[model samples]
Target: MNTYRKTFKFDAEFPFEYKYRDATSAQFELPNHVHDWYEFVYIYSGRGTFFIDHSFYDAEAGDIYLIPGNTIHHSYPVEDDPKRATAFYFSAAFVHDTSSVGEPFHYLQPFETAQSKQSFRFTVPEAYRNQIVDLIEQIHHEYSEEKVGYRQVIRMHIQHILLLLNRHAEETWGESLLRHQAAALPQWIEQTLSYIDSHLEEELGLAIFARNSAVTPAHFSRVFKRLTGMNVTEYVTAKRVMRAKEMLRLNDRNIAQIAEACGFGSIPHFHRKFKALTGMTPAQYKHSL
Candidate 1:
């Protein structure tokens, strides 16, 4: 019941957050939730089960996971031997702004691939594990100190880490270790998610979906919340807003047009929801880009 969307007030100039957990415990267990920032997690020691998207993966020392923005995930640490891990979170804008022309490097390729395949965990070759850890630690130190030029140095380290991961993904493409099978979701839930994505411009209601699934509205509401960590209304609103954002980025359409295209009832309602989730009005978000 405590599951809800999480938001962080990242620094406008440098939108990155880092954390290290010495030992995870019951009190630290996170319920299923989603966030609007990409995440990179490095397991330093111990063991755990990580639920990412629709899959559960066994996590152990030296394992790494890349989670794209707005993905549902949670971790369950083994009681006797909890996981000690480091997490790095950064905005998509941070990656796009740092990327240069003709670099032949798409920093987000690994994350994109993981999202497409629903496989987010990986391990670098034994020889490269220490190097990756060192770079992550350097990012932690620079971020903690906040000395002069720390922002630039931290950015360098993050890009370096991503570059290494992307290379590993390319080298190991289609390998068994890189393609863990995800647990299948309930048929109705999976179909509902796909339906929502394809029909964002149409009216979406719990009653409609419930009827389609041959369940009572109240029953459908409870089960949807339990499975997705979000109620039907919240999920639909989030999807509409996400689509609006893409429209804002890809075209010069007016806010009102974009809002209508995304099935918002009105401009004011769209503005309210967009600012609530993204911390900025639709116009402000467009201008920020």
Candidate 2:
């Protein structure tokens, strides 16, 4: 078992990190894990599957994924197609302190309030995608070169990207989908996620989930898919895995106890799914922790 966990620290010396990778025709496998810093990934080309928390989305070019601190996730190439992406990682403290210096404070809203539905993926328009890519490239360059005032330039670019993305989201989905969400759908989704989180020990069947959403089973299925990009079973399984991870890391309970607490019916079933999702067994995960 490769039981080496990855961790990062953000101090005065280095407050952020950026990476630009052209993963063309390579199969990269990043196991499910959490990070201390907030992460933003922009897919510049190719396609794949992005698994985060309890949802999975079809990751393609022009899609951006926001993963707040300590969220377990992993995404990789789709067979031979490859997945190229630019990643930005920073701390919430960094954003807060930087924006406190006369800049807008609302830049952290999306990240701070990243509910289940808000945490996954956003597909940007082509024009906006190009602009975002350019900005990300510039940040990467500034970080690599460390020219005069590079840190300030990088901070400015980060704020610019956030503001632009906020505007794009407001114009694109906020007016329509968000307006509807504010009315009911968003609340419904939030409540549903909360219910799942709180009731992990119960038998969370389709009908029960549908009832929580205030819709028929069929309609609930459709709406949930449209909103979350994952079906009920997948979402439930992902949530179970996330909880199991937490237990493995924090509790001294045996594997079977953690499995039962996480809603896995049997130890074997739990072991299989845990390995499949996390690329490690419960024992290995605990050892890594």
Candidate 3:
């Protein structure tokens, strides 16, 4: 039972997964810098301007901007117009590994950068964008309510909202994929993840997890792979690697202990995966980063 759970200050959270709303300001206000994780800012009802990757864009209601991790970006209100926007943040690895391909949520990039900065951006269809806004507003409403096990509920809704973004992603690639066709993700992906974090060292496998997530092995594997861009086994490895990296950098645990704590079957396997993902091995990365 590996349950991953850690809380961060509102000001500093990465692999941060939450929805928030901000009121429009009369004066321009923004700081130019990148965070340790990714950010998605959705304009619900706002007239504003954004500076992303050194380029500018008009931020109107229904606009969603995808800001990659460590990619410089900032914002400012549109003169005196009232505005309301919501945002969510996480890491690329929070979504998938380096080897994973396919721009599932890449469509939200700010287009003004494409010509000048050569970055790709896509627009969420007006209809779908409306759906996303509704989802976020509902999620925030539920968040304020704090019903039973609200954390877990919000996580599920957030995942559902992500499924919407995932659809937009496919559309951006000129591929039309419906929500049901978006590839079913595990119902317990987040639950299983929460458990995984708490019991990182527990020996976990697909057989038991099949029951845990309440799906048959075949269906579970299919949905898990489609959503995560990795098979269950690979996803576990990636999770372990991320845990290892976090431990190595922030905790007092040494390499061997951290590897063991993160549930690597062996030290060699951990090191191998570490090197493959990062150009440098864990030891090298820790010292460098």
Candidate 4:
């Protein structure tokens, strides 16, 4: 498998979609939705909760969340005033899934599949509370200024949001740190993990990722296993075959095209792998879907 998604082209001259959310009192409401692309969300004031699949997280000011492709989530207010926040959404492949360098910034390793339906809260820091203000200011600046390179400038700010989380995630995760972010993802490794999700098409052999991450294959294997609680190969294979099922739901293309698009090497190979993963052929799965 190539382990890549054909990158999506954003409407660069303008924006596919752009908006800002701010509230002073307490207010939060979101219905469950599974985005086909990506979402970057940040909050400034008020307290609320985040619901991802099954988990419920306590949310507050200065919190940031990057919801990856094909994820189902919702939000509700802790109180009922005006909670402030800003969010951006676009195709997951809008950023780099892979390259000679590494995966794009947004592709974080998925929250555990078994754990997806659960919500976990994060801790917020007073210091980064100020930083979150700075980030949102810059994001709005790029959005408002619409400078010559504002498009790319927003992308850089988006990347900065994650980097800020990586740095302050633990300190701010006051109560929810362990339950949500976990030890496996420190900072850089967390980004590494997301790449695996974005690039599930390529062959995710341990050696390949180790080389990409600039870690020894053996060390990458051990560290990844220790952090994520799953070995490298297991994680990659599971995501690939499972995503194939969802792509099947669109039901516009034939099995071969679906197979290729989902990153399987060929139809026969995809068939074999599909049955192994789902205990049924792709045709059977399609009918069910």
Candidate 5:
């Protein structure tokens, strides 16, 4: 199957779920997928390679991965031993809804940091390992018991867990958080992404992009690739293709119009790149839709 984005709709009654799972290497393999809710995994015991976007981690027991929604990731074990882990899934709505009672930012720091260039996977410190494990176990107990106000209880426990993780992130990362934020990428990359979206119909040249970023072309290219996992040209091409796809479905514009609207100099170039990235021609995709 073509690797496509996967969006999950959380049940209204129970917007959070957690469980302990044990599986062999074969069963551990999952597709390249993205979800609409946050997923936290604690590898209790096992050895595996965890794939997150263009990055991979050599995972083992006590390692934790905090994957934000819409990030593509999966895992594969390296050995025949059963890989055991506990997974917690929760939605952004759940976090926001519960923040009224307590400070959600206290628990959301690590997750927010993950959005930046910081690493998402970390090994639990020996000092806090038991405390973290016990919290997971308590969540599991609450899930299994189905007691009164169990959902509320789970949310409360999740808030506590987030606080613990945020504290750990602060202690472990320290001042480096600021450094990473500063050094992660040129601030203009974010601005450029927005600018590109707003002006897809206008001329978008590497020189212009470099000028907007206030950096040399070569330096801009290097930092863009390092932080975005794609070079400037590739990033712009992807965005244009995404815009064309949306226009194809939402507008009555013909293919040629879409090509121009998406800033493609030629319809043929639009067709080629669109097919290369989406696995289908623009015409086919629109018809399929």
Candidate 6:
């Protein structure tokens, strides 16, 4: 299986997008992929299965899945009972801008906590499901109509929806409504991922990871690929490129310095890998920003 990054182009002014899908839709399927925007999938009806990062969950009517950016996931409707759902996608900046300083509540707490715990599936109480649906419908209306001040209307509704979910999480802190599955990745693999992230600037290779994990390189490679859908080299290079993108956007670091900090051996090598993953040279990406 080939797991690739999925990219979306959002409007600079309002970086939020919405999609609704029903059984009759031609392509109501999700392939294994990761993206750079937070997402919410609300199941309007029917049933399905959702695969997120290291576990799978059974999805049904009234279910809501919170997917944080950069997490790999896939969803498919059941053969006998297809699912109909609405998806909301927005950027981190959108959430940050909506928040005020010294505010006690966080708009992204549900998503952030879910990502950390590998538990992405949840369902509100029966009484609140309608309200959730109503808010989402309002957002859809504002988005579709695009009348005067529609963007502000949509933003308010989006914030309201997030607030509802956050409150639900708070009210039912340890309830069964929040479904958490057993992690599918082995303990060692999980540790390896953490290690790679913290030590991105260090020299990284298959042999080093395998040796550190106390397994043969070939065996480690097979298990890693099977779980992540990417070979070790591919995963490492992708991570480095992602780190490079962040540095480019946030700092004034030159391309060569960023490349060195991101573990690429040379500027030419960095250029090749960055363009291969992101469809633009480093300079072009920076200029676009």
Which candidate comes out best when scored by TM-score?
Answer: 1
Tens-place lDDT digits, model 4, residues 1-289: 1112213345754333434875533222433444445666667677766644323456666566656554445565655545667777765344433643653333333222123523233344667556756876887887788889877776666556555555554344434332463342445466566676678676667877777788888888787654443467655655677578778876688888888777788888889877765667999978864
Count of clashing pairs, candidate 4: 21
Evaluated against the true structure, the overall lDDT of model 2 is 0.70
The C-alpha stretches of model 5 lying farther than 4 A from their native spots are: 4-10, 97-106, 175-289
What is candidate 3's lDDT per residue for 1-289, written digit by digit as tens? 1112222355232244664777757453434433546666777785755654323456667666666543444565765676677777664444442443664333323322332232323356778777777778777877789788765555555556656766655456533321111113244765664575567687877776779888898877776544333466665665576667667768777888988888887889889976654445888968966
The better-scoring model by TM-score among 3 and 5 is: 5
Error of 3 at 96 (Å): 6.6
- Candidates in order have lDDT scores of 0.79, 0.70, 0.58, 0.58, 0.70, 0.80
Pairs of residues clashing in candidate 1: none
TM-score of 2: 0.60
lDDT of 2 at 158: 83
Q: Which stretches of candidate 6 lie over 4 Å from their true place?
A: 1-5, 9-14, 22-34, 43-63, 70-84, 92-130, 141-150, 168-181, 214-216, 251-253, 287-289
Candidate 6 lDDT: 0.80
Candidate 2 least-lDDT 10 residues: 175-184
Which candidate, 5 or 6, has the higher TM-score? 6
Worst 10 residues of 4 by lDDT: 106-115
Alpha carbon deviation, residue 108, candidate 1 (Å) = 2.7
- Which stretches in model 1 have alpha-carbon errors above 4 Å? 1-13, 22-36, 45-62, 69-83, 92-103, 116-119, 142-151, 174-181, 214-219
Write candidate 5's Cα lDDT for 1-289 as tens digits: 2234444456786678665765546443555555546888888786866656435566768777888864656666756665688888887667654445654454556777776654667555676678878888888888899899878888888877777777876776644322221233345876776587689889887899999888899988887665554566766676677678768878999999999988999978998988876778999988976
Model with the higher TM-score, candidate 2 or 3: 2
Q: Per-residue alpha-carbon lDDT of model 2 for 33-108, expressed as tens digits? A: 5565688888877887765654556776777777776565666467667778888888765565543667455666
Worst 10 residues of 5 by lDDT: 176-185
- Tell me the lDDT of model 6 at 117: 68
